[model samples]
Target: MGKSKVYFTNMHATIKENLPQKLRRLIKTAGIGQIDFDRKFTAIKIHFGEPGNLAYLRPNYAKTVADVVKELGGKPFLTDCNTLYVGGRKNALDHLSSAYVNGFSLLSTGCHIIIADGLKGTDEALVPVKNGEYVKEAKIGQAVMDADVFISLSHFKGHESTGFGGTLKNIGMGCGSRAGKMEMHSSGKPHVSHSKCVGCGTCIKNCAHDAITLKDHKATIDHNKCVGCGRCIGVCPMDAVQPASDESNDILNKKIAEYSAAVLYGRPNFHISLVIDVSPYCDCHSENDIPIVPDVGMFASFDPVALDVACADAVNRQSVIKGSILEKNGHKHQDYFTDVSPETNWRVAIDHAVKLNLGNKEYELITI
Candidate 1:
């Protein structure tokens, strides 16, 4: 495959052109208009800031993307699926509340917000993965799969498990339903934490496979009957049920690539990643640490893989911020992400995504 085109524009703004206007120019120059979006439901996948995390992309940027989609005759909506871990966004009602708290209302973004997975994070569509290694069918949010066109507007940042969360991470893990997220993060099924259990019987009532039984005033899971749908993890009031997040980082990365394939295959998709904030942890966290590096710029591409690679390269070239996590880690490895998160290898996702024919690793950065 040939080198894919990745458009870039530095954060520097002039008096004549503001940041939002610049983002509009950047994505349009990156060939966003090439897609046919006439009267189609275009899903602008985004991360609404988790309550108290200030590093997430502002709603103004989402409005810029939505405006461009409207100009192309698409019906646009901002969206994201419920998270697997316990947080402010575990379910739709709380998810919308968090988004509203972060200023993502229809008035701000010029688009409605859709929690891709339904009320309890169970509404999903099973999509069969072609040439899949680990997953046979990927469970994705029903609303994401129902869209005619998909666009990822992601905040590029560090993650404890996956090094840096970029386009692939945004689309793959972010689009997953509760069960799909469970499958990517764990090789084993969830287990009950006996010490934390209050015998509330919530897990027993929620388990569809008859996997739970209360004994000695605590809950126990029958592994033989458990299908690992992850509903118990969400419904437990005491937070006693725990997902075994024991998957190796490499395997977790590859699984993310497969899930991304499930989301983007046979669809018109565009990707944009903002390499700002450079936080040392995911936006899923309620708080964000100081940025590890100076803000780079905004990037857009038709190819998710190349877009991520370009973003990673841009981040690696910056000087580490004093007192940030990267500086404290002492840059042990050549890669800044690895130096920050020694256990993770972000390349695994990029390699697997290439093998899946998502996009070429080689890219031509077009400065607009």
Candidate 2:
């Protein structure tokens, strides 16, 4: 009902202070611990970098937040949903391996990793959002919906589609199961390319409702049986499955907002975004481009929308890296995401999320 506060701190460190302490202070000052955490199942939603992408957040930062939650008697687990596209993180085992390889280990962060979607990325809970745009309920991963509290630790970086992946992006899309992600990213149907299908039956095995079948030495999808959950896309050994149309970037962004609304329903949530690496693409890529700007520090807020807006505003104020993605246009007087991906306008997600009553767009930036 009142102005939301987004706590921030720059990369300023002197003899009397350090960045890690500053991060904890930012979380505390944002009132994340005000929620009851005793014996609660807390899900710290985060992206465990695709192995080989070195731009992800260090596990030590996760440890800091884990300590805070543990002190409050909450059972915290670092979690993320399975990917929509085929990759090393398509299933729980490979996903966990990628997570640990990326430095999110029990020894590193003092928490276990859980792929929010089940083994094949089918575990989900349909959360009904009675809104004009979304029509019905959004299907989110079961573990995320089952959690008593939600904490989104986002790596704020440039995205190919959404312009940026901030707090809302981290929770909304990041919390979705592979099918949920497919729903957000595209409107067209998903299909399995028979040419690429090796008859391996990987997709058939993973399909929850037997929507995929092998016919004439190839895999075929029965759209009637298929709920478009996207598991087949991720599990195809031959990389056969694909979304029909990539969907418009604006619709993709709006879907992301709807997914975020599903994630915030009836839960105590805290969000932290680290605007570092400043890469031009998502960490889903195996490679990361050079940083497009200096490392902006951490931000925390109870209001995910305000937190994202503050992070974007902070990134926009920085100068672009000399030879990075933003250098091509001589550092346009706008956010680097728009400069690099002109086709994408990241603000649409923020505006739409605000319209959904997720949180306010206007926020007071408090430098902690």
Winner by lDDT:
1
Question: How much lDDT does each candidate structure score?
Answer: 0.95, 0.85
Tell me each candidate's RMSD, in Å, in order. 0.9, 1.7
Cα lDDT tens digits for candidate 1, 30-120? 9999999999999999999899999999999999999999999999999999888888998899999999999999999999999998888
Which candidate number maximizes TM-score?
1
lDDT by residue (tens digit), candidate 2, 173-284: 8888877888887775699777787888887877779888889878888888888878777766678888765778888888888888888878899899998888889888
Worst 10 residues of 1 by lDDT: 233-242
Candidate 2 matches the true fold with a TM-score of 0.95
Error of 1 at 165 (Å): 0.3
Model 1: how far residue 174 lies from native, Å: 0.5
Give the distance in Å from residue 354's predicted Cα in candidate 2 to where it truly belongs: 0.9
Model 1 residue pairs with clashes: none
Residue 171 of model 1 has an lDDT of 97
